[model samples]
Target: MRKVIVNNIVSLDGCYADATGNPLALNMDAAFDQANLDSISAADVVLLGRDSFDGFSSYWPFIADAPEPDDPDAPEARALSEVNRAISRRYNAIPKVVVSDRGGVPSDNAWAQTTTVVPRGAAASWVADAKRNGDGDIVIFGSRRMWNGLLGDGLIDELHLMVSPTVLGDGVRLFGVPADLDRIECRRYDGSPNVQLRYRVLAPRSDRAS
Candidate 1:
């Protein structure tokens, strides 16, 4: 079966919410941006929680052509425009599995073409089915709640974390495990401004002994 990877940007204190008072500034790390785009490029489907979807829907679409925060003709502005365009196209084209309890249909637009709202309890099975359908690895982004649920159920195969330097006293934590995580193999990448950590889930001790 294809792997289900969870990719998220987190603060040193583990908060995933808006840290700089601006929602767009949540997990604002250049390294994380590049890494997230790379993950999206590799995955066949992107999974998101309802809350994350709402946030992304409002931000990513219009940002592409929006006026630059700084100089419009500057290199940074051009780069932002290009990245936003790429993000918009990729998000619109890739299949999206949104986990929600609402049981309603996605909106009638590009969101409809690529989006499906799976019931909360059925998310793991739906994700497994998608992976078994010959789709490449499914990448789940944002949605700390979803991450916690999937992690607890042992549905997540790998975790790609972009650890930022800043810290928030309290906010949305990415890892909300109640018990200790089973054995994990971690590989660290020296991605400056933000460190990248890749963890492969290992079999539980009891399973390994058998």
Candidate 2:
């Protein structure tokens, strides 16, 4: 069975995006590392809510299309940028399912061939069925509303949270008010600027005895 992994880059203060709904503070530079690369590359499908779908569809496809500006003083940075470009290519190739309650269809854009738009109420069943028969992992990125719904349905199998070192005093928060005490199954800190956390959600608060 395939697993649904909710992967997010959150700030130290627990915000997923800045006050203006930008994810600029997420220093995802280190994610080019092997461990992180493997996690992202393993996804055969990506699940996204409207916000994330719009954001990613506008951004990730052409992220590596331009030439990198030369900076002789920053050789390491230049090399890392190339690595990131390659990673972006791999990511763009994965199939994506965008949950949009509004009637939307894949566009004629180059990247749209791999995308599918599903209505909100129908997405839950599609995701659950995918888990039962899909070939690889289904990754969900930065879709809070979709996350809440899936979590409530007990459809998410793992959460790969990438916590950045910086703090955002205020912004749009991810993982809003919890309905229960979710359990952490495992935790690992890469020897880098960010920490990755993995958690397993237990049953709802009312279902658990004190």
Candidate 3:
């Protein structure tokens, strides 16, 4: 069976989005490093909640064309530009399954394609079927509610969280509550701007006792 990975970037205080609901508070250079690209590229299928789907679909497609080499910011922006280009290409090419209650596929005017919509209630079944008959690992990014459901359903396999150094006093948390987990690994990249915590979700306490 394929493994389901929940990968997200959050602030040090454990907030995924800020007071204004913006999820872009982290330092870009630290957030989109080589390790981030590797994790994203490892998956063949990307899973997204409605908000995540909307956010990514609106952006990544134009990333490759952005960033002017001659611009002043270019000196400091070049490395990240290349990384975003690579990630954008991979993100745009991979098939996506969006879990949403709303209807209709968003218009495919750009690189967005091979998209499938699964209603909210059926997300677990969809994920299970995909895991049974799919290829490569399934990855979900920046989808809090979806992650909550998956966590409760015991469908998530690996959880990767990139915690930034800044602390937001108020915001939406990546995980509403602490969960019992077995640490697979913890990586702190250079500069220590962010740390990636990887954990394997263990069976529920009840299940472990049986």
Among these predicted structures, which one has the highest lDDT?
3
List runs of model 1 lying over 4 Å from the truth. Answer: 18-27, 64-70, 73-79, 106-109, 178-192, 203-210
Tens-digit lDDT string for candidate 3 (85-115): 8888888788888899987575763534578
Clashes of 2: 0
- Which rank order by TM-score, best down to worst? 3, 2, 1
Worst 10 residues of 1 by lDDT: 201-210
Determine the C-alpha RMSD for candidate 3 after optimal superposition of all C-alphas. 3.3
Name the regions of candidate 3 deviating beyond 4 angstroms. 67-69, 72-80, 204-210
At residue 74, what lDDT does model 2 achieve?
80
The candidate maximizing TM-score is: 3
Tell me the whole-model lDDT of each prediction, alpha carbons only: 0.70, 0.72, 0.79
Per-prediction TM-score to the true structure, in the order listed: 0.79, 0.81, 0.88
Clash pairs (backbone) in predicted model 1: none
Angstrom error of the Cα, residue 160, model 2: value is: 0.8
Per-residue CA lDDT of candidate 1, range 1-210, in tens?
Answer: 888888887777767665453333454545566777888889988889998887777666665566556777664664475555677678877888889996654464447666888899898788767667765888988887886777766677888877777777766556666423433544344546667777776532332311
User: For all the candidates, what are their Cα RMSDs to the real structure?
Assistant: 4.7, 3.6, 3.3
Clashing pairs in 2: none
**What are the per-residue Cα lDDT tens digits for candidate 2 across 120-203?**
888789988998887988888779879767877777777777778878898888864354434564344456677677776554
CA deviation > 4 Å runs, candidate 2: 32-36, 72-80, 177-191, 206-210
Model 2: lowest-lDDT 10 consecutive positions: 201-210
